[model samples]
Each structure stands twice: as C-alpha cells, then as structure tokens.
Target chain A: MRNLIDVTDLSVAEIDELIATAEDMIAEPDKYAQVCRGKQLATLFFEPSTRTRLSFESAMLSLGGSVLGFSEANSSSTAKGETVGDTVHTVSCYVDIVAMRHPKEGAPYAAAQYSEVPIINAGDGGHNHPTQTLTDLLTIHREKGRLDNLTVGFCGDLKFGRTVHSLVNALSRQKGINFVFISPEELKMPAYIKENTLDKNGLSYEETASLEEAMPKLDILYMTRVQKERFFNEADYIRLKDTYVLDPEKLETAKKDLCILHPLPRVNEISIAVDSDPRACYWKQVKNGKFIRMALIMKLLELQL
Target chain B: MKIDSIQDGVVLDHIKAGKSMDIYKYLHLDKLDCSVAIIKNVRSGRLGKKDIIKIDSPMEVDLDVLGYIDPDITVNIIRNGVRVEKKHLALPEKLVNVIHCKNPRCITTAESQLPAIFLLSDAQKRSYRCAYCEAEKTRRV
Candidate 1:
C-alpha cells in the first residue's frame, strides 16, 4: 500500500517516474482521458478547502472518472462520531481511490491504515501534504526544465507552512540544491526540518531576513503569506507583516529566468502588480496541481487518469 | 474487602489515589476471572492521593493501554507472596499496530487493513507520534 503520505515516501526514482508520467499526461491528454472511466475517486475532505477539493475532483473528471464523498466533515457521517477507520472501511467499498483532508495531522494516515484502496493525503493539518509537493515538483520540472542544482528561496511563514516544509524536504533529496530561507526571525523554518531534512541529509541552506538580498541569486522565489495569527503580540504583527511582499521592484532585481512561486490564497505577500510578469508561476503552479494529481490518480489506481 | 493474593499474580501500585477506576477500565481487569481488589482514595505520605489494584491471578495487560490511561503505573508480579518481576509500564519502542490516530487526514487513519502505527518519541512525556503523519499526542502510562 504505497500511500502518498510524505514526500520521502516517494523515492528519487519514483519521483522522477511521477514527473515523467506527468510529462506524458501533459503531452497526450486526449489519449489518457478515459483511462479511469468506470472508477470513482472518494474525496473525504474533513477540512474546508475548496481549492484542493476542486483540484482533485477536476483531475478525476478530466480523466473520465466519477467523484463521490463529502466536501465538509459536517456533511458526512463524522458528525455522528463515526471513527476515521469506520468511515474509510465503508468508503473503500464504494470508491477505487481515496483522497482525504482533515484538520487533525495524522487522520489521513489512520484512514489509510484501514482502507482497502490506496489513500492520498490531500493535506493533514500542519503536517505533510505529499500531493502539493508533487504539484510543486511538476511545476518546477515544467518551468525550470529540471529539479536539481538550483538555489530556491522559501519566503514567509516557513515554520508552519506545510507547502514550504514539504517542498523543501523534496528538494533536499536532489543534488546541489542550495536553499535560501527568508523570513521574519519569529517564523523561521522549524528546527526539525533544518536538522532532519537539511543537515542530516547534508544539504546546504542559508537563513536570511532579507528577501531582496536573496532575490537576485535565487532561481526560484517561493512566497507564502506570513499569517497574522502567528504573531504572539499585535506590535510584532504590524512590524513583520509586510516584510516579505514580492512586488514588481523585487522581481526587477531577480534573474530573468527566476520563477516566483506561491501556494496561493495570498494576502499582501505577493503584490497584484507582479501578476503580469512571466516569472510569476504561481497560477501555473495551480494548473500543474491538476495535471500532476491527474497523473497521480491514474498511477495509484493502475489507471491512466 | 480482603482478597487473597495468589502465589502467582500481578499487583499494581502507585496509582493516583482517585484514578484506580480509570486504570481498572483501561486494563479491563474487571472482566477477568482473577480476584481483583481496588483500594481507592488512599492517603500516602509521598503522594497526596493514591489507589491500589491487586490481581490474584497472573494476567497480561496491554502496556500501551496502561501508558495511554495512566503513565505513572507500576506493575509487580507476585510469586509465593514475594515480588518477582517488577514491570514498569513504559511506552513501546515503536507504537505501531495499535491505537488509531485521532487525525482523520493521516494516511494511516484512512487505510483499513494497515495497523494503526505510532512511534513513541518522548518516553518521559508519554508523547506518541503517528508514524505516517507525525502527529503527537500524550497518553498516560
């Protein structure tokens, strides 16, 4: 049961394979349209995430597969105290594959533990979101034409941002991948990610408070919203909230080939003025999410979705 | 209630004074055939509140369950009115194949056939983390 729980679960070879598969899907979308024609994807989104849910459903739909399951937990049997195991046990009988999202960190893993079908972790609280990592990988592969030997800067709430954490962990496995972690001192990348993923793996990464200084040298500038609630005090929020915003002026200092990425729902972190730049690949990142997920659904079920 | 301790039995001690029932429920000792004695709300010079549960027959209890319910439990095997093997309930090396992680988003939580896997990262803190999702939760042992 090769569940997509973490980025590490997919080895370098498997990741390359997934990237290749995604490339194939991109090349020949019509050929693989009806691959999972009779299959159904059960999207058990316990959390309220319209974007991820729509992405998964759209992927299934584009692949000629049917979709079932609830968008919110309140619409499901979970409101009656139905255990995750029981919910999965029942849902597995009805669907060919399952994509689950929940606020509890390990809930999807627990569901996969008892599910008959393969489980895809859509997102698990502040924990790992392997599919999003796959999306980021595909976007990086499509945009940069490679996933190695590049300097990637991760800006804003790196500490608790699951997307940043997952992508950094994924990129750490590749060779000559130097990372620039740009953030306020309070929301720096967590110690475990620094120690376990970077240092333990012998990856070189430098931490800096200045995004503009790190901009020119970066091949990829990944922006994330510095959440207001992460501030312990109001004064700290006012001080650091606008520090990492990537406006047009910042991109002028960056390389022409440098791609700016954001795992969207941006507040002020990414200026609206930067949208016209060909370098802003965040929208492309979202579309790649659908394509990569389309590839993943097909691969997991042995279908061509 | 006076109950005779068998030649071979297990005695649980140092239970928090009023928490004997929780331990009893967690251990499921009441369902067993063994003669069990539970002394509740007992006074101790060391502990402000304490209770005791003595089982008159040898039985194997789920150590993980003990850890989950009350982490401060001490188990002593009695042989011929003498303490033989003292088993201190410690968290398991790898908490796999038990206790379903409460997180619904976890891959382990969604798979029906896979064992509920957990790894006890902190022994002192009784913090068991999910093997797949890495969600930490404290269970008393």
Candidate 2:
C-alpha cells in the first residue's frame, strides 16, 4: 500500500529486514531466483541512466521476472505528450510493479499516486533514489556486519548528491553512528539536510574539506562524484574537486577495514588505483544494488500485488 | 465596536486592505447567491490596515484561491448567529483535478482536460512545485 519514494519511507526495522533478506538472497540465490516469476517490472525512465535502468532489469531478471518499459523519454509516449499519471495508470495494467526515474522532482510520487501496482522511485530528479540507499545499507551490513556504530565519511559532492542525502537520512537513524562530511565549501551538504535530518536527530557529524584527515577514523567512506554541472563557476569546480581524490596513497592512511562505497558510474572521485585495494566496495555496491532491488521488488509486490 | 452576525454564514476578516477585489476575483465570490459584506480599508490595530468579507450564507471557501490571495487570512464559520468554528485555510494535501501546470511542453501541462495536480512539499516554505514540470510556484495576488 506504500510507495518507496524516499529512504525515510522505510523504517529502521524494515530496512534491517530488507538487508537481512538481501543477505539470505545472497547465500541462497537460486531459492529466490524465481519468486517473482511471470511478473513484469515497468521501468519508466524519463532520463538516461544505463547503470540504474539496467540494475532494475537485472534485479527483476534475477528474480525470474520479466522487465518492460522504456529507457528514454523519446522512446515512450512521453514524447507524444502523454501525462505521467496517464502513463503510469496505463503501464500498471501491464506490469505488477513499476520503477520510474524522471528529470523532474516529485514525478515518481505523482506516478505512485495513480499506479494500481507498487511503485518504486528509481530516481526522481535531485529529490531521492531510495533504492540506492538500500544498496548502501546492504553494503554496509555486509562489509561491517552491522549498520550501527560506524563512523561513515561522505566525501566529494554532497550539495546535490541525492544518494548522499538519502544515505545520510538512512544512516543517521541508527544508534552509535557518527559522520564525517568531507567536501569543499561549494559542495558541502545542503543546509536543509543538515538542519532537518542530522541536527534534528542529534547525530554526531563534523564538516571538513580534508578527506585524508578524516580517513583514518572511518569505518565506511561513501564517495560521491563532484559534478561539474553543479558548479556555476568552472574555477570553483576545478579548485575544490581535486582536493578529495582517494588514491592508493590515501588508502594507506585509512583503516585497514575501511569500506569504500560509491553509488557508481563514478567519475574519478576515487582514483582507479584504489579499486584493487580489497576495500573498494563500489562494484560490490553495484551488485548489492541488484540484490537490494530484487529484495525491494519482491517485498513490495509480494504484499500488495 | 459592534459587528453583525448571521446564521449559517462565513466571516472572512483581517484581509489586507485593497486586496478584497483580488480575493473576490480569485475566489469568484461574485458568482454566489449569499449577501456578502466586503469591508475595505478597515482599521486594524494589529496589521495597521485590514479588510473583511462577511457572507450571509454558508459557502465552500476556495482554499487555493485563499492561498493565492494571502496565505495569512483566516476564515470563521458562523451558525445560528453564533461563531461555530474559526478555521485557517490551507492548501489541500494533494491538489488533483485542479489548476494547470504552466510548463507548456510538460506532458501534464499540455493535457488540457487533466487537472494540474501539485503536491505540497514544504508548507512553511510556502512553495508548491508542479508535479509534472518540477517547477516551483510562489503564490502572489
């Protein structure tokens, strides 16, 4: 009966259950491979995102379910000027569940408002991507063996990183967790998040520009890309972005067990040299993305559809 | 300091002076059958200026129109010449089947028959983003 539009939509217990279900799926993959057999996942992505779009498909396929819908706005009735509500209502008839990504904020919520089937917000502009938060959660649970008591560092772009905002909103709820916000001034976490979520929760976090200084004490380093488009001035982007790259040299200062996580298609926020360090969990994060989505698809559709 | 009371009516008070006409146009209050007392340039110790509109019959107040006119205005429901309830009008939870998305190219904005639906994201912020275009709208009347 509920839609997964934001990470806040899933309670702490539900998140734990989702991570636990993902763990079980990982251990016994074949058992859950066909749980969603014959069901279809309609992915209405108004924006082009190969990684996210494919992850949903991979998740559904791994669940023995079929995938339907479009990747781009041009390919869909959106090009013909069909309304999002109409599109979702129409697609809901053909699919048991829906995942929609749009360039506009709240578009998925609008779709969810009318969808007869369960709706998953793949990504809605800069608003949220709850599934990515699920991936981060599963990764944290797998790597750290628990979601609590970890000092997680979010480096690089935080200002406009929906994944960063979603992850922070998700993790700030857990007990004994602390945060190190590593970003340049221009890309610092938005005030709304700091004021609304972190400060309101009374979570312990410090904002800093230096990653190396914060690296040693962290249990998880969640790196997000420093987007060029986010900057109004090219000089600002140039000056601030290069300050937080995580190379092998920087990894030596990090904890031996530090889990490096990124919602991927990363653009050099973490150097390629750090990829083989066994601590790099971004690719593992991607795989976890698929399984977590599989868990979500099963969880959402099983109850309602 | 005397005020007339009406049975089964509404009393809109503390509106900004000179805004009565705007509120009237916004709410389309002219179309209704009830006797309406629209007091303009009224004295107010609190606001330094004010206006009031009294209706002699109960009418459904258009909150969207109210939201557009001035978010600060208050409404009072009167029954049997006694004040029953004083309600502060607010934007509805989800404005569906009303308004039109302004973005001409947006799918929902283009669909003439479909109501322009907008979900109120931040209430205190007094901002309504178009559900289709992701455009932010500020109420000014």
Best by DockQ: 1
Q: Calculate each model's fnat, 2 decimals.
A: 0.62, 0.19
Task: Return the top candidate by lDDT.
Answer: 1
lDDT per residue for candidate 2 within A123-203, as digits (tens), equals 876667899999999998898889999999999888778799889999989998898999888788877678658877788
TM-score of 1: 0.75
User: Candidate 1's residue-wise lDDT over A188-209, tens digit each?
Assistant: 9987678668887788999999
| Top-TM-score candidate index | 2
How many clashing residue pairs, candidate 1?
A: 39
TM-scores of chain A across candidates: 0.94, 0.94
Report the lDDT of model 2 for residue A89.
Answer: 97
Error of 2 at A12 (Å): 1.3
Error of 1 at B47 (Å): 26
lDDT of 1 by residue, B1-141 (tens): 245455778878889877888788767787898578988777777787788888888788677677566656788888888888887876676765556667655555554555767787666766777776666667743
Poorest stretch of ten by lDDT in candidate 2 chain A: A296-305
Question: Candidate 1: which stretches are off by over 4 Å?
Answer: A227-241, B1-92, B96-117, B120-128, B132-141
